[model samples]
Target: MGGGHTGASERASARATERARSTRLNAAEKEKDERQKNSPNATKAIAEGMNVISTTSLKRKRSVMKQFRGKESIFKRPEALPPRFKNKDVPDYHKHPHKWVRYTLGDVSPEDMSDQSNTAAALSFLRELKERKELIDTNNIELEVPPETL
Candidate 1:
């Protein structure tokens, strides 16, 4: 008799658990349906709120910009300031001269003089300068002065 009573209690507990689960499921389904029905209204409210916020922000920004625009000095600078440096009549050499020197290793082409390296290219350049009498060898020059002249 005790075993039968325990068995009946177990079956009643299982049925109670199942009924609670079904009630929860039904509540979840009702909530979902309510949300689906009210979603359009919620979205409309959110969109209207966003539009109001954006328009207020835009108006505030416009007002700030207008304040900044009005803060410009009333006394404007004269437009005729001797035309500055634009029309100051530069010389022909300053405007457009011939030779433009770039003292860089990359500027010296190895193919032009068939130079193997940058040092060789520089040496060849110095040699050309010496041939043209532009580079004077000052290393051999010795300063000599008479003792009485000092």
Candidate 2:
């Protein structure tokens, strides 16, 4: 009877130790998981994995401004040439005489005329001046000076 009681006590103690060890292991695993979730490297790896999955289903976006790349000058000259000058047979001089005049008057350089808005504005101002009879010379062949002189 004494031996039987000792045996039962030993078995109970062994089971209690096993239960404690298992709980400790569970706590340690939970802590490890928490640490991994908070680590920068682990977070980055998870993000990269998600990106790969998303990229497979989603198309890459292209910039609308990408078309404008390497075409800075084209934006400056958006307006089409006049109909009469649209013909390939028209001489370059006849195609855009105002550009030449602008160059001669020193109001703008060839490079400056690349900006369509500025060129159009300047040409419209000159035309308006001519219409108002504010120009000293109306001849298209010569550089005209505004009465106000600059």
What lDDT does the true structure give each of the candidates?
Answer: 0.62, 0.63
lDDT of 2 at 118: 84
TM-score of 2: 0.32
lDDT tens digits by residue: candidate 2, 38-104 = 7565667687984533331222112323433574231255688658644558777787886675336
- Which numbered prediction scores highest in lDDT against the true structure? 2
Candidate 1 residue 69 Cα shift, in angstroms, is 60
Per-candidate TM equals: 0.27, 0.32
lDDT, candidate 1, 17-130, per-residue tens: 878767765685676557644655545647787453345444644654463354433357777655457556876666676654436667756576563675786998999988
Q: Which parts of model 2 have CA positions greater than 4 angstroms off? A: 50-150
Backbone clashes in candidate 1 total 0
